[model samples]
Target: MTDANTTLPKTNSSPWTSRPFHRQYLMRQANNLFDFFEAPSLNPKGGFFELDDEGKALSAANSTRQVHGTTRMVHSFAIGSLIGRPGSGEMVDHGMDYIWNKHRDAKHGGYVWGLDDNGVTDGTKQAYGHAFVMLAASSAKLVGHPLADKMLADVTEVIERRFWDEKVGAVREEFANDWSQITTYRGQNSNMHLTEALMAAYEATGEKAYLTKAERIAELIIAKHAVPLGHRVAEHFDENWVLDKQYLGSEMFRPSGVTPGHALEWARLLMQLWILGDKRLSWMTDAARNLFRQAIELGWDTQHGGFFYTLDWDNKPIMREKLWWPVAEAIGAAAFLSAYDRDDYFQIWYRKLWDHAENHVIDHARGGWLSELTEDLKPTSRLFTGKPDIYHALQACLIPLYPATGSLTAAIIEAEHTVKQHH
Candidate 1:
């Protein structure tokens, strides 16, 4: 229940930000996650298995692999490899091989949405999935995976040729397998993630085009849309790039009204974009602040110490259930905002958010972070079943360990180089 604008005395005593012990704690948490997901996530049939609550594969033979889950495993394990974790390289290799051999549409030229042992369960090509594909490729490239270059090139082509709508400076939402039946529904979630992938891709390849596209998406989404709405990120839009306030597609992905988690996510991404663009886009920093403010102001459940999943146009909490990713993203955003402005407010929130995670979200007895929780912060699986994701929690632990200026991969590389030089 801390006010976003509550001015407090500046203090440099945040243990999470300054202490060596807390740094080690962060690394320990990260490595625990890597150890948790690295084994069971690998599916011998093809892509990753959806893990159950106890960190076991839910199904091996008949499990369906969503593009986002598959790609996230690749991306997370690549980070593991970069940090010199054992068996991480093989995890990356397995994901790369599966992506190329199984997920990639050999006939259709775009990646499929879902696959199983019988093959192609859902053939719709989504910008959201493709964004994660780009992310996996870029992370794999950083780890020196042999297939990274080809995969990156292919996904880039698919995104440009099919998804990228130059008229609006953002990618289109979804399409059918044969590149037909293009959906007229436009969304900010996919585009936001694509901005992340493009930045990571730019870091991997030194491609200005990728960075430029990322900048365009940031401007289109955050500056053009969210800024006008008091920094509340509108989730759904129409083909004409107009806001579709009444559009409610899915409970998991496309939900009604505003998503505070995405606002928290954009706050972090906008700061990274600003830093990567040499801080030329000054408006990005301001936008990041406002978005974070709005999210905290409107989304935070003051009584429960967690963020609400969704909010209405009136800034009322719609889905009051708490989820893990938003708290994770809030940690990341607060870390960057604190680093940039040296404000005690951000620093205080950074610590408080992590405290919340340690208390409620993270399954200390188990392995991965719990996905869903009730308003009072008890574990629940109403929306997400089992512990199927490591991306958000991993980033929450790792992003703070480095400076806020670049992609986590780049920051990892730079840190390694500095370590070797000093030695």
Candidate 2:
């Protein structure tokens, strides 16, 4: 392992960005991830299964299927199909079938949160999960899946009628299965992800409404809320859009105080939003830089060689355990910043972050990345069970291979068009 105090050798030119060798390395990593999850994740009875460390399903039957997990599988495999990976279309089809048949609430308007072989487990409809539903549908649509358009349109209506708050320019947090409000709580995490899905929807369908809503969300969350807090995004908010500094929900999902991982994610999302809008959002570039800088300065542990999970208002580390997703998000944010600004600073951080991931987070012996590590970079599972997600880690590998112009799907489509024209 590389020493924590040592710096990687610097070069005048970026050693990895846009280079063919690096692209091949990234492609291999992406393929290894697909190999790890593709077979084990397929639960024949309904939706997907959660995988263990050795890439085996935790439960063969009657396992809980969360909406986010189901949707993420669809989105990831759709990318695989677009990239010409064999057997990927089958996985996408399986996930799409399960999402439509099982996860969708036929009795209620929107999708349910969790399901098992028997029936619904948690019927609460959440904006966070629904955002992923839209994302899955959009990615499937990009790959021309049969049910993509139907699912996309259905989720769009549900979001508009139930979640979207026109008065505040963001979506409400949660609701019961019967379409009743579950809480007056509002959250930036949901809105940030919604911004991501809305962009994917626009790329898939070319609908101005989707793009318009995405812009509204960026303005409300990043420009209005985060800018004042020194680019540290507050997680919880009240019904009237007031900040809730004391709010604590799920340790894995909603931890108290500021989450630097989220700020890194928003940095990447804001950059994509700026690109999709033809660089019309001039302020977003600066905001993206600031967010990235804040996350690195406050969240990254210089001696421990990883990002802390959470920080207090004073920017001190609250959750000292380092997690994989934050490192993944930082790699992505670094890639975007490196491409946008053409700066060696972002490039240096990009290499450093990848080095940390390859050394600590990635299970070189196993097929997937470890979810959690102690501050000293030892693997631990206190916060996450076996490797249940590939969304963040996969993107961290693949996003750097594509141009920083738009979302991954959009970049894939553009690449395909470019190749065909040359042929």
Candidate 3:
């Protein structure tokens, strides 16, 4: 294996921040991915069709059109539209229409989990999915989509009324169809995503309430949950929001043990939260740095070049297969930390992770990315089926290029304004 450290961007230097032309090129490549996933040829019955590994639309038999997937595409395109990419608003409109018309339960109060050609296949109302819907709506609102404001308000209401637990300062996990029964399971994963959505909400609407909710969540997860458990963010939890270290849930979503990807992801979010905190909450910076350090020390596979998907409580790699999103989140975490703190180690990680992605994850021929790779660095798909979604990969490329002071949606808007002013 090539020495990843040797190929890194010069230590202690911020190439992504200093080199404008290269940053433009990289951001364009990321935008091209949004174009690739637009999938104009594929028919959109309710939502945009899922793309295969090669960027073509998956066949109807293979497509279940997850709410999170559809909302992510909408959120991505809404960012594109905010950045002045043509045809992006149209895509955002399509996704918005689908979510409101098809994915939302007319009978129940929240969005369904998944839909197919026939109709809603999985009808469970998940906080995770609803969080994405809020994110999508927040971004859409920013770009002035006709339905975005109303959708944002509606989903925000649903989240507050149905999912949020103000008493616990976090959200409940899921509910049965018709919102008839709620589960005893509490999860950090959903709340992490909720924190992300709330940040966007606060950015879009200038609502301090959203920021308040987000801060509570970060305090619970990063300060309360992860710090007590050696900085490894626990994925599963009990009804009391107590850590459930031995709970073996679904392989894809609710697996046992700590997911390093999530820790790195939360690290990034915490930094963003800190940045949005207007320089108060000095502990946020410390906590963010600690999470990044913990994830790198525990999640990184030193023998190979990428991050492990899951880690046992002992910080040992549980799932050895290297999924693409973890590396993407790692890159974002490194980029944000490097930019904010100017740490040489983070700069090294920023370069090393991009090198790893260039060598293994990015699909040069196919145009998007390889979702899964074996420990030997060969492409594999034991976990993810295809280029399922673009949220993590897109952020990995774009966040490093922007100032870490605001949300990406707001950063791109400011960037566009700056470019106009320079001209």
Candidate 4:
């Protein structure tokens, strides 16, 4: 964080306002490039739900591709949330297919945790898994996709079919094939994420059902998830919102104030709804602030510009390595702030984030972002950053110098060197 002021560039321009229109659209073309796969999900996991011809699995491997998958989902969803507008019918058709193909539990209609390397369904309905649907559906509507409204309805079916819990009005964290609550592993992280997703949907549609879901999740956060002793959130919980150690396994819950990654994501999603007069989104914004501030106080590296991979409950640096996702989430949160906040405090973090990441993650010499980096903004591992996943062209920019206006596809055609998994 030492370079916050020194490395950052002074811009007199407005935060919301971008560059020249033609150039802006050119960069945006890169954003649109991922619609082929990176942006849309005909089914949930990878949205494509099978291995590509090269034998790359359609779904992200949590461990096999740990470095990229860690935060790729957020970036993917952020991009997809904006481009994948679908209808209720499309949402259901697509969701059910994925549930059946990649995510579905064999015994029930609910989705599986995610797919495996063989592209097989080892079914479990993780809370994070379902949140993907909610977030995508909400963001799709914002971009006027023909299927957006129906996609919202399709996700509603998922909630009614599997996510909704009548007694709690909040989603239980996980479930068996039939959507029965996983009693042994009770909790609220999923609920919190679900809240974040539902908030996005609520803002996009103004649907009372979504708001009801958000409010209930908020109640669950305040009641059970929020640390009574501190401002952070417990990563796991019991059915009654009691602390549950067993569910956390050998990996003791780090008990940080709140994960900056999740907190910033919540802030962005909620802010989308805020301008429309939904005050509930404020919880997301406020919670993000608390968690981010806590990170600064407890987890930030005074010598390094980015955040640590993990921080302990009392703000101790349990894992001090810098990971890529936090930077991306921070960028997103700051982008929201630049657009909405009057003070512009977020730019401090946002600027540091870019400077740090570009130094490490962005491989200017080789191309694309690097897979990982060290505490000193150097590579810690091999250049296994990521497979060349696609994205909407609107967000993709080869560089600020050359954007994808009329030639994103053409750039791919001309690109002789590409980073990909060798089958």
Candidate 5:
């Protein structure tokens, strides 16, 4: 086995922790990721780029604009701008224009699901997309975009009136075009993203309401759902918020069984929530640690070094193919847990996960990252083709640079401002 202290920043035999050297290392990796995606990911018309297998821009004519994709680009570049990356604001503006002009439903209140050259390909109003819009707007607000606050308000109002279920602590799943017909299905996937967006919104606006809503959702996922289910979050639910274990709604979004990626992600988010809020939530800390532990134990491929995409209820690998996002989430989870727990296992996992990313996931030639790879680590496009967005990978690379309290963008922004003041 490798000596864990060899990778530690300064200490000869201590586990890795956040020091100046560690910060510099993380910054370098983050910049490498940011620089690669900043230019290539942008579409010439406006919004972000989606490339073909050859690393060329996917033809605009055939390309359809997805609400989540565009919003993710906006959020990613806005983070870049927060960290003083040049031209990132322009990219943010590009995505904002697309959000306002193409994605927004003029007749209806909320954003549409997809758009193409003909416009409005999939007109469904989804909480998943709206959550990302909130995230994008929150990041833009931090960067002082002209339309950010207005956009944030518009989305916030729509989410409150349409998506937020007062009786239930989480957002609803999907709605019809006029926002009249709501689905019977409830989903933790959308709510998970909603929890993430609410945290960002709280940080951007200091609205206690947003934080309160976030905490409720976190409790639903972490306490009600995951903690009782052996740390496996139930992805689908009925109208009454009952678990739908047999549900197989959407192949990508609502697949049956548990997604280890979301489990690891919630673990990371739970810690951030604990730190951001009262910091007295001992249950939150325990839940976070347990979730991380269970996820690593169940989702990690014992034969291979990467995480399985999905695990059956029996803890068997349902989807054997490894994707980039789970490892990215695992990296973020390990980074924060290592800092919080000072556990040597997390430190070991941190090093191992980064090594796996550097060796297998990173697209050194194409710029961004390979979205998926086979179990043997060969490149595969079955799940995702080319690089889509930088949100997960960027956060994984940057979040380790700061203490585990706030949004990655906000933390980086504050750290930069502190350094400038000191200088």
Candidate 6:
């Protein structure tokens, strides 16, 4: 029996709160890291390097080895920008020097974008790749990492000089090894994602330039990409902020279905901007709420109870599938909304998210999550049956402190367990 009151929890520790499932994931990530450092084998007996057909990262390979994107995203949480303690061992990258790698292409500016078939940094770099670097570096700064400033500065210059669409005042898709911008229609996913990274960067450094660019692009996400009445965002855009109706590629997984995570990330960014006192984008918060409810109505699985990976705008079932990232973003929304304590209408959504994460996705047996489950809450991707470093774990780490969840003690206990595994 839990009470649904708005009283904030009095926590002495950091803002990151956790639960059983989060603790399990944290432990799995930790054990997996230990396994990577301690275990030595050819394949390493884990699925950390599973790549989608298009070379996008899929999941962790083994206990110690995490995929390139997974490693970057997990660092976002551990670097302590949003919801965790800072300056910890979970950050020291033995997998690959994500921050300060002299071995990779220095001309590329961003870290090596991919690992070779034999486990070395491949030289190609993508805009999305640099975005993750900014996010992780900003988070590292929040945690008192001495190198945070350098990480933030290096990546910021790379994006500003290379990815920036000077005509439209935004970023493009990919860049050459020498930081030359790829002349193609940009991806709204990475653009939004880069804005998100910029938001964190602004929070870390209080640099007016970062915040200013982030605000302009965030407005573009609304005016340029966001469809007003339809409650959907354009997944791709031209340099002038026009919607490219011929949406192709996994720039967003748009060809698959409506991605809930992307929308939520925008919502949180809007709120963060609001906190920064950029009230010009305040209307976007309501728009963000509309998208959030759109996601809840369309993505939430009624019988099985979890979010579908993709769905239609009118609450219609397109794929009716589930993915790890959307659930993670949904967790982000619930936590951010919990801080608002506005009308009591939002509590139900948070409860549904908590209920689903606890019951279906978390694997208490293996000390992590199953990674991917179907709309009916059955397993889908065995690639991450063990704990994989992912954005989901970072998002989950914040759920307990939001005050919407009933037990602070439980969340704290879970955070404690998670940090123990990581530290």
Tell me the tens digit of each residue's lDDT in model 4 across 80-134: 3433333333443343334334444444654455454455344556666667566
Name the candidate, 2 or 5, with the larger TM-score value.
2
Task: Give the best candidate by TM-score.
Answer: 1
Residues 3-104 of candidate 5: C-alpha lDDT, one tens digit per residue: 234244544435444457766766777787777677776776656667665556676555788899999989988888887788888889999999988888
Which regions of candidate 4 are displaced past 4 Å? 1-107, 116-120, 137-154, 166-169, 180-183, 222-230, 244-258, 280-286, 365-368, 380-423
Give candidate 2 misplaced runs (Cα > 4 Å): 1-12
Task: Give each prediction's root-mean-square deviation over alpha carbons.
Answer: 1.5, 2.2, 2.4, 9.6, 2.5, 7.7
By TM-score: ranked, best first: 1, 2, 3, 5, 6, 4
lDDT of 2 by residue, 1-423 (tens): 122232335554655876888889888888899989988888888778999888888887579999999999999999898889899999999999988988899998788999988899999999999999999999999999999999999999999999999988899999998988779999998999999999999999989899999999989988898999899898899999999998988988789999999999999999999989989999999999999888888888989789899998989988999999999999999998888786566777888898888889888898899988999998888888899788999999988988787899889889889889999
lDDT per residue (tens digit) for residues 1-423 in model 3: 223353344553545557877688668768767767776423457687767777777776546888898899898888778766787877888889999998988886789998888888999999999999999999998888888888889899998998889997999889888786667989988999999999999999999999999999988888888887888898888889888888988878887788988988988898889888786988888888888888888878888878888889888888888988888898888878887775566777777788889888998887787888888889888988878887888888888877787778988887878888999
Q: Give the worst 10-residue stretch by lDDT in candidate 2.
A: 1-10
The lDDT for every candidate, in the order shown, is 0.91, 0.90, 0.83, 0.49, 0.83, 0.55
- Compared with the true structure, model 6 gives a TM-score of 0.73
Best by lDDT: 1
Error of 5 at 308 (Å): 0.6
Error of 1 at 183 (Å): 2.0
lDDT per residue for candidate 6 within 234-344, as digits (tens), equals 666666666665555552233433566667666666665665645555676676676676656555666676666555545466555566666767766666665664544
Predicted structure 5: lDDT:
0.83
Kindly report which residue stretches of model 5 are placed more than 4 angstroms away from their true locations once superposed: 1-25
TM-score of each: 0.97, 0.97, 0.95, 0.66, 0.94, 0.73
